[model samples]
Target: MQFKENQTIYLQIAERISDEILLGHYAIGARIPSVREYAALVEVNANTVMRSYEFLQTQGIIFNKRGIGFFVSPDAKHKIKEYRRNEFLKTELPRFFMQLYTLHIPMDEIDSMYREFINNLTSNPSNQES
Candidate 1:
């Protein structure tokens, strides 16, 4: 995966995993790839993936089985959505609003575009996450 320079790698990995969970790539209670496995898949060190897994565990997005592996928590989707929604509202939305204001963009224009996007998403099921 492409790593963003602005965020820590481990955090980015955590976000990717959360996104996968939301997309149903890793369903609730499903086992995720092992640390070493994921590290190899992402072309990163095992320790880095471990840190990402630890972060997810703390966030209640995943749980570790003593000898088996990690599995998605039952409420992982809800937790991921709650955390991401708040993050977007607190950071991204403000920046987006600032851009809109600076460009003197009308809300109605954005609203119409947003509605069209939603329509397309609904019509194109593959574009949406489960």
Candidate 2:
């Protein structure tokens, strides 16, 4: 995955792995790619991948199995959601708000747009069927 320069590469890699877990790509208790394998796949150094895995472990998103490889923690999905929500509030939301400010858009207008978007999403037949 292409990583942004705003954060460390290892952090971005961990976020990518968390996203994969959230999306069910890596189920709970599933074995994840080894540090060397992930480094080769993402074309990064093994140390970088190890750092990412360490971050995930600290966050309780995954755990090392000693003699075996790393496995997804049972709380991985919930942890991923919490992490993304914090990130959205801390970073993406601020950027979005700044963009609105630069565009001279009123807060009420933004709120209305958001509500409309949510309403449309909820009311869409395809989405409702899901």
Candidate 3:
């Protein structure tokens, strides 16, 4: 719930909520805390939380119920997964590739390393295998 100074508070709030939903702290179709409640929990202004909720609604990650609090969307899990995968590909992968290039690692060598990592991970019985 700690807000980053350079980022908008509303976007930070939205990311927190997204993390909750993705972690199953907020189950699919389950009601979310009220805006005032979340604001209280995060020690932020109610307007900030409201803006976050509205942004999430626009993303189809949550839906408002008449006279009730918002609920996690029915397709929330899938939507969250898709969103995270897109983010990983768009953001994380590029950075990783950049690091590999800086290290003078060839594309084939990187592929082989990745495959070995995956194989080692899958074969390790004590690792819980993700």
List, residue by residue over 3-119, the lDDT tens digit for candidate 2. Answer: 797889999899889878877888899999999999998999999999999989988889999989999998888887787788899989999989988999999987899899889
- Measured by lDDT, the strongest candidate is 1
> Model 1: residues >4 Å from true position, as ranges?
106-130
Cα lDDT over the full model 1: 0.94
Ranked by TM-score, top first: 2, 3, 1
Provide the clashing-pair count of each candidate structure. Answer: 0, 0, 0
Superposed on all Cα atoms, model 3 deviates from the true structure by an RMSD in Å of 2.3
Clashing pairs in 1: none
Give per-residue CA lDDT, model 3, range 18-60, as digits (tens).
9898888999899999999999999999998999999889888
What candidate 3 gets wrong by more than 4 Å, as runs, is 4-7, 125-130
Q: Rate the local accuracy (lDDT) of all candidates.
A: 0.94, 0.89, 0.89
What range of 10 consecutive residues in model 1 has the weakest lDDT sum? 78-87
- For lDDT, candidate 1 versus 2, the one ahead is 1
Residue 83 lDDT (model 1): 84
Query: Residue 50 lDDT in model 1?
Result: 99
